[model samples]
Target: MHYQITLAREVFCEGVGLHSGKPATVKILPAPENTGIVFIRTDLTDRPRIEAVAENVTTTLRATTISKGNIRIFTIEHLLSALHVYGVDNCYIEVNGEEPPVQDGCSAYFFAVLQKAGKKIQNKFRKEVVIDKIYRIDDGERFIIALPYDKFRISFTSLNEHPLIGTQYADFIVTEDVYAKDIAPARTIAYEKEIKHLQDMGLGLGGSLENVIVYNDAGWINKLRFNDELVRHKILDVIGDLRLTGGIVKGHFIAVKSGHQLNTELAKEIRQGGC
Candidate 1:
């Protein structure tokens, strides 16, 4: 039987936050079995620990997670995605700012950290929420649905407005090799127009041509690893968001133009103890 796991030792890294534009440091430490994923704000006047769960999600505007008292940590999807794929059941994350550093704008860095720190299996059996029936919700053009499946699978279709990223679809089954080799390194991307708009809204302040794929009418200023990287990134995002279930999920999820909002909504619906 599968068991809960945590890192064997603490790992540390630093990078710039995708949204806050602030340089931050993070320490990923092991936690006892069943402790779940918790975020501690080490830089705040009061050190507050924020549990990583759907209910504590305070913001989704361009990738942000906050606790009940407004304590937050941003740009956590990549790291969260990595943890879910690796089957790590619990962790203690300490950050020195409001957001996690966007190291290379992908989970590659975090994956490396986990590799170096290693993992220790706990005695408790890992808990999982197996989907019993279809659960779905939609908002305008965006939607998501979950159906019963033995393995975690994600399928996404994105209608990107940028010329370089028109329409694309990507599919993946959650596995260590699949996630680390296929999805973890797939960098986050944004259109040139969206970059300026986000900056105007005081977001994506740390965004640069180096951290993300910038597209324009002429095409990407840099090379793309996959033709449908936009869609794969969406799949990556949804994987991390659905992890808000606070346990391994056994199901298949289908999505179209879905973001954090729809992702968490579906999790909330399931948490209400419904089918």
Candidate 2:
């Protein structure tokens, strides 16, 4: 039987948030069994602790944000994705700002942190959710296809208006080693035209060529980590958002032109007491 697990020791890091663009230091600590993943906002007076669950997700614009009453944390998908890959069942994540640092716009940094901190098995059996049927969700231009499987897997197809990024695809069966090599290093990407629009919406304030892959007709503004990185990044975000289901989801999720909103909705649908 698989046991629940958490970090063996504390891990600390700091950087600029992808959304708020504010500075933040995160302290990740081990938690007891059944605690789930919780984010504590140390900057607030009340020090609100928000749970990472589909219902608590407050925003899904370019990233996922979870809130509880007066406090909210932004751009947490990357860290969550790392936790999922490592099979971390419980953790206490404390942050000093409103959003998590978006290092290189990928899950690699978080994976390193968790890897360094190590894993400690808890005394309780880890909970798992097995898909019992086909679950589908669509938002007009995009949709998700979730099918019963014995592993957490994904196949993503991304279509963009950019000439160089006309069509891209990614597929994976998630595991610690597999994810770290195949998906964790893929950086978040955006088109050249969306910069001004995103900035106007008060998003991507800390964005730069150093952290995000900015593409246009000219091609990768910062060079390529993977030629099909755009689609792989989409799968990374999907992996992150789906972790909000609070356990491992045994299924193959096929997403097309989907973002955080659709990802969280699919998690929400399956989480309404499972398949």
* Clash pairs, model 1 backbone: 74-99
Estimated TM-score for each candidate: 0.96, 0.97
Candidate 1 lDDT score relative to the true structure: 0.84
CA-only RMSD, every prediction? 1.4, 1.1
User: What is candidate 1's lDDT per residue for 73-120, written digit by digit as tens?
Assistant: 777788888888877789999999988888887787888888888989
RMSD of model 1 against the true structure = 1.4
lDDT of each: 0.84, 0.89
lDDT of 2 by residue, 1-275 (tens): 68899999999989899877888789999998999999998898888899999999888888898988767898999999998888888999999989988988999999988999999988999888677898888978999988988888999999977778889988898888889998999999888888899989999999988899987777677889988988888998998898899886678999999999999998898899555
Report the C-alpha displacement of residue 1, candidate 2, in angstroms: 3.2
How far residue 198's Cα lies from its native spot in candidate 1, in Å, is: 1.1
TM-score of 1: 0.96
**Backbone clash total, candidate 1:** 1
* Number of the top-ranking candidate, with TM-score as the measure: 2
